[model samples]
Target: MSGSVAFADTTFIRYPRPAAKVDSHLDYVNELLTEALAFSPRKYQLLPSKATMQQGRAVHEMKNGTGEVDLLWSMSTDEREKNLIAIKIPIDKGLLGWRTPFVISENRQMFKAIKTLRDIENYSAGQELDWPDVKILENNGLKVEKANSYEALFSMLEAGRFDYFPRSVMEIWKEQEVHASKNLIISQDIALHYPAAYYFFVAPAKRQFAEDLTNGLEILIRNGQFERLFLKYHQSSIQKAGLKQRTVLELQNPFLNPANMPLSRTELWFKP
Candidate 1:
C-alpha cells in the first residue's frame, strides 16, 4: 500500500464554504500534488485534517515519527524556512504582498493624508499575534497591536482600537463584504507593498516531499496549468481590488532570508 500524505485544512484561506467540501486553496494544493506525483514512481494517498493555522504549524514542528501531517502552506519567513523545508514557489503570485486597509467607514478619511511609508507609520495597525507580518510592519516603523483571534481583529478595528487593519488585496473585498455590517470599508486610496510570498512547507526530514512539490509546481508553470489554476480562483478578487487606482506605499521585508528570495523567477510572480 502507498503511504498517505496528510495536510491541514486551512479554512480561513478562502470563502464560500460548501457544506461538505474542502476549501479552494486546499483543493488546489491536492490537485497540484496529484498531478506532480503522477510523474513519479511513488504514489501516495492524501489525508486532510481540519485544523487552524497555528495548530497545523505545531504539528509540523513536532516532526515526530508518527507522520501526523506531511505539509503545510503558509507565509514564508526567515525563521520558518530554517525550521521547515519551504518550496519557494509563490502560490498566489505575490498577491498577498499587495495590501489595502480595512477602516471604520467613519474613519476612512484618516488615511487620506498618507502618501508614503513614513506618513503611514504614524497610524496604528492590527495583526494576529502570531503573524510574521507584525514584525515586518514594526520594522518599517509602523505601530501594531495584536489580537489572538482573527474575528476579534475586526471588532478591535470597529472599536477604533487600531487605526487600520491591513489585508491582502485578494482578501479585503471578501472580508469587507462579510463584515460590511460591522461598519468597515476597504480603503480605496492606498495599497501597501512588501515582499511577501506563501509557500508549501514540510518537515525538515521530508526532503523528498518538498522536491516532489517543487517539481510539480515547475511542471505546472511550464505547461501553463499553474496560471490557469491561479486565475480560476483569484482573478475575480484581483480585478475587484482596483490596484491601479491606489497609491502604492512600498515597505521592505525585514524577515526575508537571502536563500529564499524568488525575485529572479518572474514568470512565477504576478505583476500588477
Candidate 2:
C-alpha cells in the first residue's frame, strides 16, 4: 500500500482442476501467489478463472492472452520460457526435477535387474504428451509412452503400455495412495534425478506484472516466508521420499538454462 492508486488490476489465475476441490499442488501455489501479493507496493486482486482446462490448453491460452488463464504454474521448459514471461525464480525450488520411477507392484521386478542408464534403455517410460519430462527422458536415450492426460498415465502403466512412469518426489507418494487400487509401487531399486524447475508464467505483455510478482517473492524469501510455505507443503514429502536410500539414476536436463535460474541462491534449493 505504499503507492496509492484509484484502481488496481484484478489478476485472474487458472482454477484448479476437478472444480470443487484443489490438490495440494494447486493449493500451495495459490497460497504462495497470495502471500507474494499480500504486501506489495501495487495492489492486485487475485481471482480464479471461471473454469478449468488441461495444462496443454492452459499453456496455449496463456501464450495467446486468451483471458481464461492469466497465470499458470508448471515445470519450466525452454519453449515455455521463450513464449511466456517467466518469473525466473523457481517457486518449487527445483524440486520438481527429482523424480521417482514407479511401476505395477506385480511387475516391479522389471527394474530390479537394472543398475545403470544403459541397462534401462530398453524399458519405456510414460509421460504426459505435453510435459517437458518427455523431452528430458528422450534426451537421455529412454523411450517414452506419451499420455494425453495425467489420469490416463497410471491406467496405462497398469495395462503394461509403458514399463514405468517417473514422477516427481513431491507428487508420487500422494498419487500412489490416490490410485492405491491400481497396485502401482515406486521402484525401490532406482530413482531418477534431473535438474529442473517449476515457475509461474504470465502472458508476454505482463512483463512488469511478472517482475512485480518476482520482487514480491524475493521479499518473502528475505523475510523467511517463502521457505516456510515450501516446508509446510513439502517437508513431509521430502522425508517420506527417503531419497538417500535409493539408487538414484541421475539424468541431464537439457532444458535447464543456468542464466535463467537463480543458482546463486543456495537456500532456495533442496539437496538430497
Candidate 3:
C-alpha cells in the first residue's frame, strides 16, 4: 500500500533562473492539491507554506526536526534521520525525471575539442557551489570551480576564466539558445544522477493529520487514481524527448473515471 503525501514545491527545475515567473515543481503539487481536496475528506485538506529562507541560508530550517513538520516527503536518506518519516515512492525508475547540462559557447579550440566528461575534467569546470551536480562531479575527481551566480559562470566561461559551465539543460536553453553558442559546448557525459521527488513534511504537532493524509494517499492507490496523476504529466515529457507514449490502465476493482467524477459527493467535502 502506498501513502498519500503533500510536498513543498521544488523551486528549481530545468528552466531559466532569472525569469520573473519560473515554472517550478511546486506548480504541479499545487495542482494535485487542488484536485485531491475534492476527492478526499474535508479534514484532509493540506496546505503548503512558502519558504522563508533564500539562497545561502542554512538548510537546517529545511531539515525535518522535532516540533517541525511530521512527515517530509521525498527527502534523501540523510534527511530522514534528522526527523523525516520515509515514505517509499516509485522513484528508482527513470520516471523520476532528468535535467541535462548546457554550456555557454562552442567556438574556441578548447570548447571545440571537448565533447565528454573526460574532456572537461582536463580543465577547470564552473558550477553552482554545494549543488548536487557539483558534488557529484567533485566526488568523481573532476576539478570543478564553484560560482555564486549563473551570470557569473557565463562571464567566467566566456573570459576563459573557467573551462566549462554546467547547468540544467532547460535553464540554459531558456536563457540562451544552445545553437547560438559559438564559444561553449555542452558536455556529453552526465555529471550526476539521483532520485528527486516532492515530499511531505508534517509538523510533529500534527502527527495525526499526517497519518490521515497518508491514508488518503493509500485510498488513491487502492482506487488506481494515484497512477493517473503521474502518467498525465509523464506523457508530456516523453513526447518532448521523442519517446513513445505509455498506455494508462484503470487497474482496480470498481474503477471510476476521474473526469466523469460527479461533483455531488465531492461537494460535501471540498467546495470548488
lDDT of 3 by residue, 1-272 (tens): 12332323211111112211333234544554445444544334343323322222223333323221223333233333234343333311223223334454453344444345455567766876634445545655578888775456666777777666644322344334433444555544433233333344444445555465566655665675665665554445433432122111111112112232222432112110
Q: TM-scores, in order shown?
A: 0.83, 0.89, 0.53
TM for candidate 3 is 0.53
* Candidate 2 wrongly placed segments (more than 4 Å): 1-9, 13-22
Angstrom error of the Cα, residue 126, model 3: value is: 5.1
Of 1 and 3, the candidate ahead on lDDT is 1
Candidate with best TM-score? 2
Candidate 3: list runs displaced more than 4 Å: 1-21, 36-59, 62-75, 90-97, 105-119, 123-130, 147-198, 203-205, 222-224, 242-272
Per residue, candidate 1 scores C-alpha lDDT tens digits across 1-272 of 12222222211111112222223355566676667666654444555534444533443443542454567766788877777777888887888889989998998788777778888877899998877789889999999999986778889999989999999876676677667679888888888989988887776666766676678778888889888888877888888788898889998898987456788989888888
Q: Tell me how many clashing residue pairs each candidate has.
A: 0, 0, 20
Q: Give the TM-score of candidate 2.
A: 0.89
lDDT of 2 at 27: 69
Which residue window of length 10 is worst by lDDT in model 3? 246-255
Compose the digit string of candidate 2's lDDT tens values, residues 119-237.
88988999988788899999999999998778888899999999999988888877877788886898877778888888888877566678788888999999999999999988998
Report the number of the highest-lDDT candidate: 2
Q: Please report how far candidate 1 places residue 94 from its true position, in Å.
A: 1.3
lDDT of every predicted structure (CA atoms):
0.74, 0.80, 0.41
